[model samples]
Target: MKKEASAKTWNTLRNITLVIILFIFIRYLFDEDPFNDRIGWSVLILFWTFKGLFDAVEDKRSGNKKSMVANIVFVIAGLGILLWQGIQFFLYK
Candidate 1:
């Protein structure tokens, strides 16, 4: 990979790791509370999807093909998980 792509990849990984840790911390804080658990999950999923959308838009404007593709993947995966979790949360509620 080019140096730019490598650096971008590293930053993306770091950001994703931080988001996971934040979500875990929040989940622990609201542990075993049904409504709060759903809110936590929704917040994390929305954060990820929105992050992907913004990144993809920026990369597209900058003409970074690879990073744009990766961000699109993230957006798709995030939305898929969001849909799956939404159904479960609704049914439980």
Candidate 2:
């Protein structure tokens, strides 16, 4: 079906976007000073979190249970990492 195909394409694009954002975030983490780059990192994390939620919604609407679960997992893991980092920076630094 055309609708199914379009949903798949959109999901693929979302995945690609998430990967690219993550790659840039990792590179920035290693290459820049965290104190100066916190805003950039926060923005990237927020974008990644929202994108994951959006993808999960799309997957659910398309009846793709597996992808929906995966997206939910990714969101949880990403948020966990972000919280951990925040605590480390705020409490330990």
Candidate 3:
């Protein structure tokens, strides 16, 4: 029961973080100098990447195969996107 409650709390936090990241990304799309916000964006992406990985671990512990797989995919995709963005920022800067 306690483990389930902890998992729920983490899930809620991850969801909220995802929403905030999305809003910041949308705002970045409209900003005049996107590169100026690279640090903020990088931090958000790193947070999201770690959150997904932690969720994957929780899902594995709970024997939730489907969710575990989904979280793993999210983590990989997030990292890939972050790396791509970092390269772009470095190359252009």
* Best of the candidates, TM-score: 1
**TM-score-better candidate, 1 vs 3:** 1
What RMSD value applies to candidate 2? 4.9
In the order shown, what is each candidate's alpha-carbon RMSD? 6.9, 4.9, 4.1
The best-first sequence of candidates by lDDT reads 3, 2, 1
In the range 10-48, model 2's lDDT, one tens digit per residue, is 878887877777777666767657664774576587677
lDDT of 1 by residue, 16-86 (tens): 87587577748754887766766676767777787788789779978999999999999999998989888
- Candidate 3 weakest ten by summed lDDT: 34-43
Model 2 clash pairs are: none
TM-score of each: 0.62, 0.59, 0.61
Residue runs of model 3 more than 4 Å from their true location after superposition: 1-35
Q: lDDT of candidate 1? A: 0.80
- Which portions of model 1 show Cα errors greater than 4 Å? 1-34
- Ten contiguous residues with the weakest lDDT in model 2: 31-40
Query: Which candidate's lDDT is highest?
Result: 3
Candidate 1, run of 10 with poorest lDDT? 20-29
lDDT of 3 by residue, 52-88 (tens): 8988988898799999999999999999988899898
Residue 23 shift from truth in candidate 1, angstroms: 12
